[model samples]
Target: MFKLPELDYEYGALSPAISADIMQLHHSKHHQTYVDKLNAALEKYPDLQNQPIEDLLQTLDELPEDIRTAVRNNGGGHYNHSLFWKVMTPGGSQPTTELLGKINQEYGDLETFKSNFTQAALGVFGSGWVWLLPDMSITTTPNQDSPISEGVVPLLGLDVWEHAYYLDYKNVRPDYIKAWWGVVNWSKVSELAQKS
Candidate 1:
């Protein structure tokens, strides 16, 4: 069965950018619902339960039709939220040399990359995610869709879902996006990028 992963820091650690209330609700409530639903969805397919959530998402078409959608939504939620937690830290960290070099090569400079990424996040029509792909490309996926579904690994992801920022930034998504950068765990993102 799937389970919500424990955060590396306290719920209030990401405050100012992401509030303690938002963190508690997002992780313990929202993310936990995803885990519960995903596990419930797989109850009839015990064999599939042992498979990694990433594998399930990557091979959704191969799953039985009866439970495919459930797994896709809930499983994608599981994977996305899991990465979301890890990609952020209390005070944040700088990108490693390799990751910074690639970001510069692909986007000309870090500021340009941030601008592009922020724009992409804003462009998302509704609840979705903006991801930095392994190739250093920026992409957006609607709803719970993950980059793995498109055959690419995500190095970094920003959740633009209303639930992610409504309490803190209200209707100003741009403000939330800007504050979010302050908490990005670049070290973890760089590790993921280098591994890819």
Candidate 2:
């Protein structure tokens, strides 16, 4: 059975950008639901339990039809949130020199990249995510969808679902996105980018 990963830091660590209350709910309550549901779905096909969430998501169409959607949504949720927690820090840091060079090569500069990425985040119509792909491309995934399903992995992703920011920033998703930048874990992004 799949399980919810423990956070590397305490819930309150991301305060100011993401509140303790919001983190608690988003992690313990929201993420836990995804883990539970994914586990239940895998129970129907015990052999599939051995595969990682990423594998389950990337091969959704190949899964048994009866449990395909459950695995897609909940398994995607598990993978996304797991990466989400790791790609954030209490006080954000600048991208690694290598990542910075790559950002410059693609977007011309970091500020421009942030502006473009922010616009993409704001453009998401409803519950979804804005991702920075390994190629330095910006993209969005609706609902519990993941970039891995398309054969590309996200280096960094911003969760735009209301459950992610509602308690703190309310209806203003832009504010949440703005605040989110302050806690971004660029080193993790750099590592992921290197692997990508």
Candidate 3:
């Protein structure tokens, strides 16, 4: 069964930028729901149970029609949230030289990349995510969809779903996006980028 992964840091670790209250609810409540639902959806499909989430997402069209949507939504949710927690840290970290080099190559400079990524995050009309692809390109997906579905690996991603920041930032998504940078685990992102 899919499960909610434990966060590396305490809920309050990402304070000021993302409050303890938000982290607790986001991780314990929201993410747990996804894992539960995904497990429930797969209960009758034991043949698919052993496949990794990535494989399921990549071959979504081949899944049984009755459970495809459930797996796509909940499975994507599980995968996305798992990675989300890892991409953030208490104090965060600066971009490594290799990661910065790629960012500069693709988006001119770090600030420009931030501007582009923030714009992509804001551009999402509703519950979704903005991902920095392994190729250094940016993309957004609606609902619980992931770039992995498109055969692209995500190096980093920002969750723009209301449940992610509504309690803390209310209606100001840009503020939430701005503050989110303060907790981004650049080292983790860099490691993912380097693998690409």
Candidate 4:
């Protein structure tokens, strides 16, 4: 069963970019719910432990009908949030030489990368995520669905669910997105990409 990891930083660490109230609820309440549901779903299918996650995903349609949506929603939620935590930090280091060079090559410059990622994030019609993914690549995804499901390794992600920002940023989501870069742990992303 999947569980929420202990946060590496304090709830208040991302402030004044993201408020303490927002971090507390997002991590303790919201992400915890996903972890709980994922545990329940896994308990319902004891035989799945030996399978690769990709194989299990492919067989999801064949599972007993009652557990399908639970597995999809909770399982996906667990997976996405785990990646999200690893990619975030209190305040991040600037990208290293190799990562910066790649960013420049791929998006022309850092400003363009932020602009494009922000636009794509805001373009999501509802509750979702804005991701910076890797697969000899950088890209985005929507909702709790993983970029890994499409063969891309995730380097960074931003939760776009209103619950993630409404109490702090109110309705000015773009401002929240702009503020997020300040707390983004680029070194974590570079490490993940290097592994990929």
Candidate 5:
């Protein structure tokens, strides 16, 4: 069974950008529910135990039809949220030389890339995510859906789900998106970018 992963930093570490209350609730509550439901769904299928989250996503079509949707929803939530926690830090970090250079080549400058990414995030009318792919492309996915389901590994992703920011920023998604940049784990992004 999958478990909710512990964060590298304290819940209060991302203050101002993201409140401690929001982080605690989001991680302990919302994320925990996903893990619980995922384990319950997989309980009947002993053969599926201990599979890597990515492999489970990729092979969803091959799972028993009865439990496929549960796995897709909760498992995707688990996977996405796991990545989300890792790609954030207390004060954020500077982008590595190679990652910044790649962004410059692809989008002309860092600010331009950020503008496009933010716009993509805002374009999500409902709950979804905006991702920065390894190739420097930006994309969005609805609900807990991930680019990895289609075999595309994203280098970074921003959750636009209301639960992610409603308490702190209320209905102002743009404000949340803007503040999120300050806590982004750019060094982790750099590592993912280079790995792909």
Candidate 6:
């Protein structure tokens, strides 16, 4: 059975930017549901366990429609949330000088990078994610899908799902988007980029 990974930080660690209640629901309830359903889906197709993830994902579209939704939603949820948990850390420092220079190379300057990244994150029409992908690439995806599926290495992901911020920021998603940077783990981001 696939398991939901424990968070590196406490449920209340993010605070003001992301409240404890939201984290509790997002991680414990929402993410756990995905893990459970994903395990169920895989159990139904024992052969799928032997295929490469890429092959498995392609075949996902061909599964019976009833289970197709489950696999896509839950599988994507599992992948995206796992990546999300690894990329966040407590607020304290900015990106290191080396990482800042890379951001500058890709986005002109820190301010412009923030402006573009925030706008990309807030501009999504519905539930989705805004990502700062490896090597400073900024992108977004609908629902639970990952950028990795499309060939980009994800460095950071900001959840734009209302459940992520609705209780705290209410309908003002931009406020939540802006505040997410407070706890961004640029060091982890840099480490992932190097691996990429």
lDDT agreement with native, every candidate: 0.93, 0.92, 0.93, 0.76, 0.93, 0.80
Estimate the Cα RMSD of every predicted model relative to the unseen true structure.
0.7, 0.7, 0.7, 2.2, 0.7, 2.3
* Pick by lDDT: 2 or 5, better one: 5
lDDT of 5 at 155: 88
Worst 10 residues of 5 by lDDT: 45-54
lDDT of 2 by residue, 98-140 (tens): 9999999999999999999999999999899999998889999
**Reference-based TM-score, model 1:** 0.98
- Per-residue lDDT tens digits for candidate 6, residues 116-144, read 98999879989998888766878899998
lDDT of 5 by residue, 4-63 (tens): 999999999999999999999999999999999999999998879789989999999999
Candidate 1 residue pairs that clash: none
Clashes of each: 0, 0, 0, 0, 0, 0
Per-candidate TM equals 0.98, 0.98, 0.98, 0.89, 0.98, 0.89
Please state the error at residue 12 of candidate 2 in Å. 0.5
- How many residue pairs of model 1 clash at the backbone? 0
Between prediction 1 and prediction 6, the one with superior lDDT is 1
Q: Kindly list the per-residue Cα lDDT of model 3 for residues 73-127, writing each as its tens digit.
A: 9999999999999999998888899999989999999999999999999999989
Show where candidate 3 strays beyond 4 Å: none
Q: In what order do the candidates fall by lDDT, top score first?
A: 5, 1, 3, 2, 6, 4
Local lDDT at 53 for model 4:
54
Candidate 6 pairs with clashing backbones: none
Distance from true position, residue 6, model 4, in Å?
0.8
lDDT of 6: 0.80
Tens digits of lDDT, candidate 1, 36-141: 9999989999999999888999999999999899888989989999999999998989999889999999999999999999999999998999999998989999
